[model samples]
Target: MKIIDQNYINGEFKTIDSSKRLTLKNPTTEEDIAQIYLSTPAEMDEAIHCAATTFESFSQTSIDTRMDILQRIHDELHKYEEELIDLAVLEFGATITTTRRRTKNAINLFLAIKEELKSYDFIKKDDYSITIKEGVGVIGVIIPWNANLAHLCSNIAPAIALGCTLVIKPSEFNALETQAFLECLHRANIPKGVVNVVHGTGEVVGEILTKHPLVNAISFIGSTKTGKRIFENCSKTIKRMTLELGGKSPTVLLEDANLAEVIPHVLSSAYSNSGQACHAGSRLLVPKAKVNEVKRLLLETIQKLKIGDPKNEETKIGPMINQTQFNTVQDYIKSGIEEGAQLLCGGLGRVQEFEKGYFVKPTVFICQDQTLKIVQEEIFGPVLCVLPYESEQEALNMANDTLFGLSAYVFSSDETKAYEFAKQIRSGRVLINTAASKAKNPPFGGMKQSGLGRMGGRYSMDAFCEIKSILF
Candidate 1:
């Protein structure tokens, strides 16, 4: 098994005081693939203080210098993209196709932030008022196992581009992927202590990093409950925070929607990363009149989604990150049955041909009540709960009922109606008439529990910044 015992601190990979390390299981093989260091509280403190010190200079660095660092990071990451891709597949239990797509998308954000940074004028010396968008000092960047690469890249690249330092706590499940990427940062010769990567359980190191005094802000991507705890902790110092939290987002299927195209898109959005995304369209709300039709499509769609070894190019689905997640998904499936939701297809247990790994069959539940516990919660798995609504207003209410409003989808032939529906829905991003996801251009975030602020494009850069005005 490969073991990584160093945490990137003060611009270099260094070992901790003790030999304490964390061994993470390969979700696919159900065995240990690697071991990563778990930082002692003192080492975490040292990392934070170092980042705070670096921020003094980093926050004041010229945009050109920061831009150069970001450019180098982009270049180096591209060079190691293949290896990173492999690591993501291993740690992610995601198909190589999804791994490549997400990894490339993440690396692209470095370049994207470079362009976005140009739009952020750090030192404007106008007569009216000198307004500057500056970094928010040291940031604690926390990521989840699912979408590990994309989330961290989106948060950290923007911080570096905005001239802020970050202490990253990658999910223990994929420390290698995070380490490999940090290797690129180190090779970029980034300023000392500007970026540090640590690994451990959230209760141990993550708790310390989130509450550290030297940490100025927290940019977290995880469950809503954990986000709330982190938010409350940061409250002590009133540190600025940006959290991408939970989602029970819905995908509305209007009768006129194209079942062929829209079904695939909705399924992809619902099942990608095993539905672990904050934007997972876990709820499928269809018009009551077209209930049977939508159900047929969803049933057929979930059946066709090849779920198994992520290494297989033909595989469209894979296992949850670990057993805890697999069990969580299993319990939700059980609850769906206990709650009396109609089980159209899939339940507990592994895929037929592949039984050793921690895999769950892609489960779908058709329910009567939109308020059904299964319908209202974010089940981060391949489970999709199909719900039928009597009218458009009912569908809209069901979609907006949850505290999470991260993402939603509307399938309709009429563009105007789809646009109008999107306007009424309280979500960060809305897919219209298709399952295809959008790019990093427009603003993305949630209205309620889904998250805060937008990521990608200029919005992410905006999140890492603070605006100040100086009157001449």
Candidate 2:
């Protein structure tokens, strides 16, 4: 198989003119995997121009034609399932199980979006009034390294279904995976200039796409800080923006909840994707009476999780994206210790056996209260802060205390109580006795500083569209 080293523009794979390139390395083995040719200023402009020009024709394309293209893309995605999984494992240090599941999920997400398009109403008429929903125009998508494939599909599928053209800026860390995705689109015979991928630093290529007058909308998935910058650039042109930013999501366990059953779900929610997820349940709010029992159960479960080589099928936890991410996580651990949070288990540095990879232990800390840094900050790692609350109202308050309202969870034997509590929670999506990730294609996003707008299913199509009313 030939490694794809060029940028996709105008339905063609063109060589990047820049001497600079991004060298990708496997986080698990610390070995070089592939290289992505960095986009030159001219190449970046070409992509934006291609997409802006394509939108004129693409935005008028018939719904059936767009739907067929989506189906084709869906079929094309599965054809490279194994290859995608391998790339994810190598470049992302994703465990075999996680890579397989997330890859399959990413492929199926297109199919789900296709199904949504079938019932979605692009044009509606009632008596003398006509309402139309159309694509927002040329969209610039910036996806993060964590869950890159699924996140890309979440944005791109809807953009295409709504008859919009796009230029994607994938995380440099997972350039190979993004290249595979572009190849899938190319194989699907997507119309030329409809979808393009550019590789380079966010400061350059990202800034260009966001600030370009030709680009009409921006869909960004990354940290809150970066999202704000993107928002500022988009605001200059008053462009449409969809941002899925950071989260310090909380998981609240009620006093009546059984610690044994809920602890496993809590642990999985916090540690999945090695806790690199934006909506990770990093803060665990437990009843004060059950803190000791929760700690004991958490210890037992953490011991069972295998943390090592991502190639191993049994590995549940994998390394951070790179050394910088590893050090960031370690620094957060140090801060938790310094701030007087009790280290219940697992703390600091690499796992003893693995001296080569950027791995960190599945750490747990018992915070003195919600005021602690570990409880308040978005530590995107496998570090869980257990905060004990005195009452249900207090738990709800603690969960809503942060600036991030991305996701929240409540576990209780009583569904009514859980549902009632979930309603008042400040997050965009609330899970009752379940992890925050199980809802597929339902409305997903956040409130407050978690960023504006939503994604998933019909909500996604609506987000990418502009509504107009014609009164007759």
Candidate 3:
């Protein structure tokens, strides 16, 4: 088995001294793949101190210099594309298609940020005074495992663009993938102490990053529960924070929407990343009259999805991250059955063909009750809950009833009507008749308990910056 015994700190790989180690397994085969030496609390402290010290010089870097670094990093990422894709599939159980798309998107983020930096104005002047936006100093970055490299690159690009130093703590689950990414950062020739990584559990490494006084801001993408704890911890120091939390996003099909055209889009959102995405449209809101038609289309589409080893190019669905996640998805499916929701397609247990691995049946449920656990909670699996609404007003109400407002989808033949309806939803991003947004560098975050601040484009830059007014 491969062994990962180093943490990237001060632009160098330092051997981890802690005895605590996490063994990683291939989600598809349930076989041990690698063992990672976890970073200790003292190591986390060293990373933080390195980042804090680096911020003094890094934060003063010129925009052109920072842009060059981003470009170099982007180029370096391209060299590791194949390795990154392979590791994502082997470790995270992501299908090849999903891994390719995620890896591509992650690499492109650096170029996108570089473009944004080209014209970005760090200082604005009026007749009376000049307003300055400076890097927020040492930043603490914590990311989840669902899209390890994507989250890592996403968090890193913005902070780098703003000339902010980072002390990042990625999930221990994707330690191997994280190691590959760290190599990319190292080869990019990033300045010493500009980017530091600590590999350990959240209770250890994460706690230090969250509570450290030297860390000026935090950029985290994880569950709502962990985000809450981080928020509370940051409150003690009153640090700037940008949190991208959980979502139980809704896919609304208006009465006028064409079932043939829209059902494909709906299923894409529902099952993207094998339904492990935080913004997966797990809730499907349909007009009461169209429920039957939607159900038929959903089953027809789901059957065509190839579920098996992630290594297969044709495999669309892969196994869960591990036994814990598999059990969690199973529990949610069981709750749906016990709560009286009709299981239209798929049910409890693995696919008949697969005897091993954490593969869950891609399930769908027809439910009227919005209070059901399957309807209300973030299942983070290939499970979709179809909720029928009698009226458009009711549809809007049902879509916005959840505690999450990260993302929502609206499908209608009438573009104007769909746009109008999308505006009323409380989600941070409302896509009309599309699973993905085409807009460049649009703000991404959520309303209500979903998140506190935004990321992407200038919004991300703002998150890592401190604004000041210099009066003439």
Candidate 4:
């Protein structure tokens, strides 16, 4: 019973006008674990007001001073990392290892962003005039549930470092974790009103945050359909938005690839978080001649990934977040079956070892058509569709055929061939062997529907900054 009913506003914990409150639930055991204050439009306005007021001073602060505060935030983050991980494990159904690793990565991202900002030339000076990189005011951040804490810090650390104040609307599914993270922020001594967290459904908190007058910019990570709606909403204010949307990314296995070694990459790409990630390598494409061999390897590799309790240290695959997600994943599994895809491995239902959690089995389907719903859509589940292609050109074509272009992977020992194939696939990020070794300094973002703008390093700062031209 960790109750996070206080919304951070103006350097204090205050309750909103709404009498209605909600308890954040842990889906694994169907337990109500924490309570949050459900918010209103007026509460959103108050947050925007505070953030806007704080930005004037925060934005003009020296880079060195800002870096010092960021360092403090990072250190404090590391101190509470375990408790944060515990909350993540309980709320999001992430395994203990995943929760701990994700927390470290998030804290690392904060450190990396701080270091990146230290040497960043955010302003230019002239004899008669000065060019400034001023803060974008009253930012609105919408974090996805899959990797809520890390994703929040990943995009937000840089923004705050660049002197931007923001209102964050973390996914309703992960509100309890967010409340705890905000509590840590307060403990870390981040100035209130500099960052505010509001809890509610998308229609209430999300829509209000997007449409707020003082909110000059927005950053959202979710599906393309939702991203499109958010983009449209912000268009009314002509707000600058960073949209990290959907992905039906492909893993291309060249004819020369080693099936045994490459199989691990395929499993990690497609089945991590039960394949709920935006960049999960869901659509795995194998060469026509090697299709059967790769399929067998993929099935074996995926089967080896431990699935069950989120609290288990050995578990690699955890339960789906909630009943809605479980049903959606099951529907996708059913979609593959009904669409005439050959069921090569897992089909549906719970793992034999776990009966209580909202779990989905690791499912694989071999489909001839690359354009089917299961193939083309963002299933966001453990289900993977393996498609065969006649030639390299066809593989690249099919990989780039989706409306979502978040990430793409190519596995080949031939460097020249890998780079050539990477160029043809239209994605924001491309993984030749692995996904950039999960680095923090690498610029993280997607191209096209994957979203606009970039994050990580100086890119994170850029999202929060605006340029001013100097004329002498």
Candidate 5:
């Protein structure tokens, strides 16, 4: 077993007191894969100071230099693709196929950043004034456990490409992947202290990063409740914040939509990542005339999903992250049953075949009451709530009723009508007759309580930059 028991600070791996350590478990086997010492307050302070001090010079580095560094990092990521995928399968309980796709996405983001930097204008000239875009300085990135590798790259790609120094706090659940990523940065020979990694619970490292005086901005990806707390903490110093929070996304199926084509998309949206993803289309709104048929189709398809060892290339649904998440999802399943929602397919308990690991059956509930708890809250599991709608206007209203505005979907034979309807939904991005995975760029984030800012493609540049106007 490979053990990573140190934090990366000042361009070097430094050891922490082993007495205070966090053990990371393989969700598939419920066994310890790696253990990392939690960074002390003093260690976090050292990282912040290193980043702040380094930014003065690192932020001024030439764009070509930054692009070269990004290219090196991208190449290193590809070189270690198989190893990273193996770690993800062991730590993520992720299927090999899913892990490969995620690794590809991570690599592609860096490549995209490099390509975009070629045309990005750091200094724009006008008649009398010159507009300048510079690094925001000392970024604090908080990554959630789900899709840790992909989200880690999503933030770091733009931060580094735009010449910002970073202090990253990846969730303790998957610190092994963080260690591997930091190794890539080290091998790529990035400037000393330009990037740092700290491992600990969010309360310890996360709070310090948000409240640290030297930190200029905070970029977070997690729950709305936690995002709000980070916002409140960063507001004290008037620091910039880009939060990508929770989502209870909805998918609206039009009356004329073909059931065969739409069911697959809907299933992929709702059950992707075993329904743990924030943007998972947890709510499926179909015309009342077709609710029964939709439920039957869902049942047939869901039952056919291979729910077992994530190592299998064929497995689509893996175990939940840990016992706590497993219990949370189970509670939500129980809540649906108790609240009078009809259980269409799966309900309660583990996948009988597995004795260990946190696995919940892919659950589907046909809900008549939109006001029910199951329909309103984010279960963050492979649970789908099927809601019936009588009219197009009603479906639109139902979809927009949630507190989250992260993502929405519309499927229709009429392309123009679907486009117009997408405009009405309050979401950061909308997918029409397609899976969210088909997105080309990273212009993805949340609106309302879903999130505060956008991060993807050229837009991510906006997150880690400070704009200034200079008179000629």
Candidate 6:
């Protein structure tokens, strides 16, 4: 078994002194694969101090110097691409295809941020005064287990570009993968104390990062509940925060949309990352007249998805992260049945072939009630709720009814109509007909309770910066 007993602090990995150890199992085989010694409160404090100390010099780095660091980090990560992919599959049961795509995207974020920094203006001068942007000092990053590396790189890229230091707290479930990522950073020769990682439960490491006064800002990617708690905790220090929280995203199929072409896109959004994504289009909105056709297409498409082994190239869906997640998915499935929603396909229980593991059946339900728990809550599993609407306005209303406004999808043959409808949905990103964005550096974040601030491109640069006005 892989034993991870160190925390990456300052310029080196230090052995953790805490006796608290977390054993991680392969979600696919239910076999122990790694054990990690959790970081104690004292260790977390040391990491924060290191970052804070480094910020005094790191924050003054030139743009060209920071860009060079970003490039080097990107290259180092690429060297470990295959190892990271393997760890992702073994540690969290992610399919190889999904792992490769996410890993590539995560690595590319650094290059993208480097490109953004090339032409970025740090200071703007006018006849009266000059406005300058400087790094916001030490940043605290809290990442979730679903896409831990992606979140890590995404948050780190911007901090590096803006010459800010970081103290990261990654989820304990993916220790091996996190360790591999830290090794890459170490090999890249990043400046001492510029980036540090602490491994532990949220109650210990996460709380310290959020409440510490030395941490000037925070960037978090997790559930809304945790985000709210962090928000409350950060209030004590009045830290600048950029929160990328939960989502119950909607996929709306217009009357003019071709069901054959659109059903695949809908399923891709709904079930991507085994439906464990914050931005998964878990709520499907369809016209009342076409519910039958949509149902037929959905049932037909779900059968073709392979759900056994995550390492297999053919597997599109994989097991839940652990028994707790598996039980949560099962509970949601039970609620769907007890609430009187029609089970369109895939009921409770694991796939018949798997006697062990945390695999869950890809379930779907047809329901019109918007208040049902299955329809309203964020079930982070391969389960979808289909809601039928009478008119376009009703569809818009239904899509925006939830507490989340992270992402929304609109499908229509008429581009103008889809674009118009997308504008009305209250979300950070609204994709017309594609599962992924075609834009190179589109800003990403949510409105309302979904999040507090944005990340990506110039928005990320701004989030990690503090502005000052100098009088002429």
Clashing pairs in 2: none
Write one digit per residue (lDDT tens) for candidate 3, span 1-472: 9899999999899999988898999998899999999888999999999998888888888888999999999999999999999998999999998899889988999999999888888889999999998889999999988999988888889899998999999888998888898998888998899889999989988998999999999999989999999999999999999999999999999999999999888988998888999899999999998889999999999999899999999998999999999999999999999999999988999888998899999999999899999998999999999999999999999999999999999999999999999999999999999997778778999988789899887788888888999996
- In model 6, residue pairs whose N, Cα or C atoms come closer than 3 Å (at least 3 residues apart or on different chains), thus clashing, are none
Q: Candidates' TM-scores?
A: 0.96, 0.97, 0.99, 0.96, 0.98, 0.99
Compared with the true structure, what per-residue lDDT tens digits does model 5 show for residues 329-373?
A: 999999999999999888999988998899998888999999999
For candidate 4, the TM-score is 0.96
Give per-residue CA lDDT, model 1, range 221-283, as digits (tens). Answer: 889999889988999888888888888878988767877778888888888777777777889
> Can you rank all candidates by TM-score, best first?
6, 3, 5, 2, 1, 4
What is candidate 1's TM-score against the reference? 0.96
Give per-candidate clash totals.
1, 0, 0, 1, 1, 0
Model 2 segments more than 4 A misplaced:
1-4, 436-438
- What lDDT, from 0 to 1, does candidate 5 have? 0.89
Span of 10 residues, lowest total lDDT, candidate 6: 434-443
Is 3 or 5 the stronger prediction by lDDT? 3
Candidates 1 and 3 compared: the better one by lDDT is 3
lDDT of each: 0.83, 0.88, 0.92, 0.82, 0.89, 0.93
Range of the 10 consecutive residues with the lowest summed lDDT in candidate 1: 433-442
Error of model 6, residue 74, in angstroms? 0.9
Higher-lDDT candidate of 5 and 6: 6
Residue pairs with backbone overlap in model 3: none
TM-score (C-alpha) between model 5 and the true structure: 0.98
Candidate 6 TM-score versus the reference: 0.99
